[model samples]
Target: MVNVGAKMDERMEINILDYRLKVMSIAKPAIERFTHALIDVLFFKSYLSGGCANNQHGFVSVTETDADYSVIVEEEAYKAFEGKSQDVKVNEQTWLPLVASTGPAMVVQNAAGISKIANSVVIPLADRGISVYPLSTYKTDYVLIQEADFDKVCEVLAQNFRITREGHLQSSEIVVEPTRVQKALPSGAGNSRALTHTFDCSDTNTYCMTSMDSKSLEPHGLAIIKALLYSGHQSEVQTSYFFNLSIIEQDISLILNVTLLNKFPAHLFFDNSEYWRLITIGDMPEGVGFRQAGIVAQISEPIASADISEYYISSFYYGHAFVPFDQFDEVRRLLIKKQNSQKAAAAAKLSNGL
Candidate 1:
């Protein structure tokens, strides 16, 4: 628990939804006051277990006064935070001496000019080339600074501006190395054709859980891609979520329309019984095959969006009627008019100015 009061300028705003982090002077007495202050605020009775003990950092737990409070004294944050070294603020003139650490970085244009000051040295996490923003973005939570210039930069930060503890923050970390395997628009995603499933979910090959390392699952994958590529496809997918699982008509695994269990049929990758089979408007499985029409496909977001540091995300080459999920219908209608518009919108910026 902590015991300190804070005052901020009316214009400054920092909103951390669930976790609360308030910073006070990182000194000895100030630390004590801050700890008690936290205690006083957190004194309410928690319906369930509450209290802190030693943690990964070997810090002592907070001392609770309430007899009913969870005996496991809430671990005191100040324990570790106390007597710890603080990061001196950094500036642009500073050289990032070390290989930049990978993580989410907050680019806050607290006032206006700080970004400019930081830009001479600090760079947004994803940008590789020369583009820069005054209200530019940041690559890591911490600023990039030369260890030698650290003190000089901090002086400028503390004196000239206060970093807003809030803003549009983007993270460049992802669990999966999202990969996209290109395939013919009218065809399925990339995968070794050798592996095959019991039921070919493809337009040509019917197989379930095929050993084939297929990216798009033909006919089945097409349905999903159809919904994903186009916007209005949400209903098709939303409705499909219900059929995620239903009583099976065939001992032979069959996919079922999550919504219209009676209509569309294909083997589901996930068990609907456990109820985890909802289709996302964004993702489509690879290795599935479909009727070829020489059309192209594209991704909705950037390749970097996958948190991938490398990999050039190219525009889908599929020549089909490509329409964003939002303009699916308009694009679909355009297709009806015999226009070779699989997708009118560029998934990402493509080689062509289209």
Candidate 2:
């Protein structure tokens, strides 16, 4: 573990280890293909947040829309009927024609919940054209190609997507002791009947202040406050918000917990967009240049890649070295050794100078 003073040397300024990563962009044709574009035709929504039932398996969207693909293929089949031996074709016994099971039929639905039957089902549909993909009875509309056409499509899309290696700042949890937190907070902050909470998680909006007048909360602020209370915090009386959104309203649903325990509430608020959802606290710290660090050491060990994400140091801090927890002890030991080696090298230089 890293000691509080590890490599400190009184270094408080944020040490950013920046690196450049390359990202592949789609070409004009690919862009025109409209990858990851939402159809919103089916509008398949559930009350749940996420799980395997919600998220993807190996590769969920391996479709023509992928930058890794180019062409698309489709097929349509017809049944053949034969005549009976007698002059009267079906007088004796009628015969039925069977269609090939190469691919199954699917349905397509529009925004109005109106449905249409499609000729065939597209597993991962094409990027363009009228197509239908089956997810049980509720079919999603999209441009589709046949699985038999996979190779041709992928050949066109291959390498259209390039990989970029970007440097990142690390993330670390700051477990503030309630005592220390209490000291940090202004007095009279905790003695509040009305809670002022920013209706958004991102701190880019107005701070929330108290509202003693009992009022119905919009659905927006409901979930997080419930979490705070359900965490079993002493919320005999707490503030709330309801974030019921309208199609026309542009307000964001991201509310933040900004109310002080008792004093006037302070925090930022904004509609939670994609960028806000995928950021770290360090990315938007409460104050200027706030950083958190932890220390660990291993006497003798090798590196492991499985636990890199757990080592939350912003990439800005650790360079390209994604130190995993299993190997973190090794890193500490190696760092200590590197320091000793560097000092020895310096001393040798000085001795030679002497």
Q: Which sections of candidate 2 miss by over 4 Å?
A: 1-326
What digit string (tens of lDDT, one per residue) describes model 1 on residues 1-354? 111111211222222111112122222223333434333322221211342211111111111100101011112333333344442111122122111111113222231112222221222211111111111111111122333433333232221122222222532211111121111121223221111211111111111111111222333544532322232234544312111110100111222233433233434343333111111111122211222211111211111122211111011111011112233333233323322232232333463656
Question: Mind giving the per-residue lDDT tens digits that candidate 2 earns over 1-354?
Answer: 222212322322111112111111122233323321211100111212332233211111111111121111100000011121111111111111101111112222221111121111111112221111111101111222223332332222221111111143453222222222111122212211111111112222122212211112233234333322222233542332111111101111211223322222222222222110111111212211212111111110111111112111111111011223233444445445544665787799999999
lDDT of 1: 0.21
Measured by TM-score, the strongest candidate is 2
> What TM-score would candidate 2 get against the native?
0.18
Q: Which of the numbered candidates is closest to the native, going by highest lDDT?
A: 1
**What are the Cα lDDT values of the candidates?**
0.21, 0.20
